[model samples]
Target: MAATAAGAFRRTPIERSDQRVAWDRTDQAFFAAGACHILAWVCRESYSDKTIEIVAVRLPGQPQVFHTYAAWDGWAFDHSGWNPEPQLLAVNADFEGQPLERLKITEGLAEFCQKHHHRTPDQYWHDPRPRARDYIGRYIPPWA
Candidate 1:
């Protein structure tokens, strides 16, 4: 994930060609039956010195249908856990309902950070562990 200022993050919608874009956890539940878009982002929390990753799905033809998962441990989907903060979770739940042309990722991220700052950060960091290396290995050649 790219490094950035506090509360800054990157949003990427898994493309049709990306192998990983195929049906995954976000597609299992009834909430995502018509999901056509899967998006993810990575951000840093300066206040807690932690890194956070979020993955979300949008159901086509359903503007209000949104499901998201958050992970403070690492970038892998399995490591992600549901955000317990209702107010912040609501931001994600209602995100796709807004006008995409007018919605700014940065603005939405800032709002999320503002609402969830009160919670304690996750204690484990994956950056230094085997899971982190294994994930990177997916794209990096052994010789690299």
Candidate 2:
């Protein structure tokens, strides 16, 4: 089990190399998935300052999407001061009928971050909004 700053511990299965890139290059969009997974792990482990309220997704080829929500009760993060209901982080992409593949990528990214440090090189580790933006701008667009 891995330890987190909020005292939350969880175990994740390691991924194989083939499962890492199962999506087609043209229609596969794992940017948001990767971001959310990494952000969740980071928030749970290193920085428990601001709670991740919600993660909403609107994919291009999927009928039903996925959403994740978290709340702060003084032990972790409290973004309620900025917004009464807590702001959500939305991820728009096209899974291309490869939901399972997308999930693998997300999990892989989180595990990779947990084992390796990708956020340390970043200057804005404390801020999620900026870090998300930078990630999309720098990595997501290029991958797409």
Candidate 3:
């Protein structure tokens, strides 16, 4: 299901995100891979009823952030689809032996949000908007 949804995405051109992201590669199958912080913010605002929070992680000794996503109800959602949070964390932490620290509330995500997300912050400093929200439905499964 996640893969199917990912298939539907037309990858956003990542020029702006280059200044914000730290991930070594953005050629992953998930369209949001390059702009995870932006897409995650979109998902969080679009599904406010789910009480989703944006989250991110860093390499063990590196300050640079990576792999942003939305979390709620012990589950996590990204362009790839939804998965149990623990499983997702485990996979994200050690994918291809690129281990990372535990997920953290997206405190470090503000700069990305500020630059790319152009929505009313609600309470956030620079939450993103409509286009991201519009893109979200394609990834939401019925059970979710």
Candidate 4:
């Protein structure tokens, strides 16, 4: 599944872990990766507002902020506004719904998320890096 918005496109229905018994282990991995302090798998009753919410703290003692990303059309993710940091990028990346592969931790938290959750860089997410920078990062292919 894919979503097209403002001429931009993205994929969906990403599986971070197996749906069965692996769910618990996968959740732990995601937490250990430091991508988020609390990752909740929520089910919305309305299609008009169904989404996955990921709450995290950028650093210890920092205020906790709620980041909501859509998990429809076969993908999951949210935009980081304009700030581009590794931690924010990692949190958004996790919602991308794709497995973490070949993704490096330019930011400590993103790297932690990738390693602990076993995600690929090619996975979809609203990357804060510029187009050229995003490509150069090799976290995901620009053309992809």
Candidate 5:
């Protein structure tokens, strides 16, 4: 299914997460790729599970941050936020509430980066740019 056609995935709010991210260099590369869809696609190709999803979210004013994780049983694994990296603003899983698709993610990312950042697919893919820091530096739990 198309990324746009897939509609919105249910937003899963993470109440608390550990302070440090124990990801290795390869894992960090995947998270970095979340900023650009082409890199995301490349990441998907390298991994064994093509079903893994990559999500990019942008707040009203902040630069977009990408979250690369797999959704299962209404939760995301290998997710980042409420920790070293920026807090995740939103997530799109696949259908049946899983908001992910390889083609759609890449296409949407390409369109968005080109229109907003004036970046071509190749430029965004090849360039070394800092990832988006945080959607909001502070976090207050829903129950709070």
Candidate 6:
């Protein structure tokens, strides 16, 4: 399931091409940059039956989300791959060295994005459904 979810978030050459400027400007890989939340939302849709949550990493007390991923049963999955939740949480340092906070959003993607970004996912990044379908096809996860 994790492997499939990771694959679903992998950007194809053209999707990469769609955001050519952001791709060229960043050091982060595919979904690691601005699109991490969309990646998490797609992954959550893949494992819909589980108690998976979309987790956002942000500076403490800040409404802005710096990163996002999917978490289920102590494991976290992003485009980068899987990590134990604790290890994933260990990397949240800002330029000033303030420890960022982890926000677990269970209310769905619209709620998550609206709360963190003051906009819906489509307003923030490309709508995720097409990319998810492109990779996962009609294959539902085992639990589903």
34-131 in candidate 5: lDDT tens per residue?
Answer: 33344343333434343645444433344543333332223222323222111122224322243322222344545656644524434433332223
Number of clashes in model 3? 0
| Reference-based TM-score of each model | 0.21, 0.24, 0.60, 0.18, 0.30, 0.64
Which pairs clash in the backbone of model 2? none
Cα displacement (angstroms), candidate 6, residue 46, comes to: 0.7
TM-score of 2: 0.24
lDDT (CA) per prediction: 0.28, 0.28, 0.55, 0.29, 0.32, 0.59
lDDT digits (tens) for residues 1-144 of candidate 6: 222222233455665556654444322244665567776777777666777788877778887777778887887776546666676666435232667778777776677666766334555245545554344343333333
Candidate 1 stretches greater than 4 Å from native: 1-47, 71-144
Per-residue alpha-carbon lDDT of candidate 4 for residues 53-107, written as tens digits (9 for 90 to 100): 3323222333323232223333333232222234334544456433222221233
Model 2 lDDT tens row, 15-106: 11222341221111222222333343433343345443332233445533342222233221111111222222211112133221112123
Candidate 4 lDDT score at position 48: 29
Candidate whose lDDT is highest = 6
For model 5, the stretches where C-alpha displacement exceeds 4 angstroms are: 1-38, 60-109, 116-118, 124-144
Question: After superposition, which runs of candidate 2 have C-alpha atoms over 4 Å from their true positions?
Answer: 1-17, 22-30, 58-63, 66-144
Q: Scored by Cα lDDT, where does model 5 land? A: 0.32
For candidate 3, the 10 contiguous residues with the lowest summed lDDT are: 2-11
The most accurate candidate by TM-score is 6
Candidate number that wins on lDDT, 4 or 5: 5
Worst 10 residues of 4 by lDDT: 3-12
**Candidate 1 residues 11-69, lDDT tens each?**
23442233233223232221122121121232222113544445443344443323433
Residue 56 of model 2, lDDT score: 27
lDDT of model 6 at residue 84? 68
> RMSD per prediction, one decimal?
14.6, 14.6, 7.3, 16.4, 14.4, 6.9
TM-score winner, 1 or 3: 3
Could you give me the TM-score of model 3 versus the true structure?
0.60
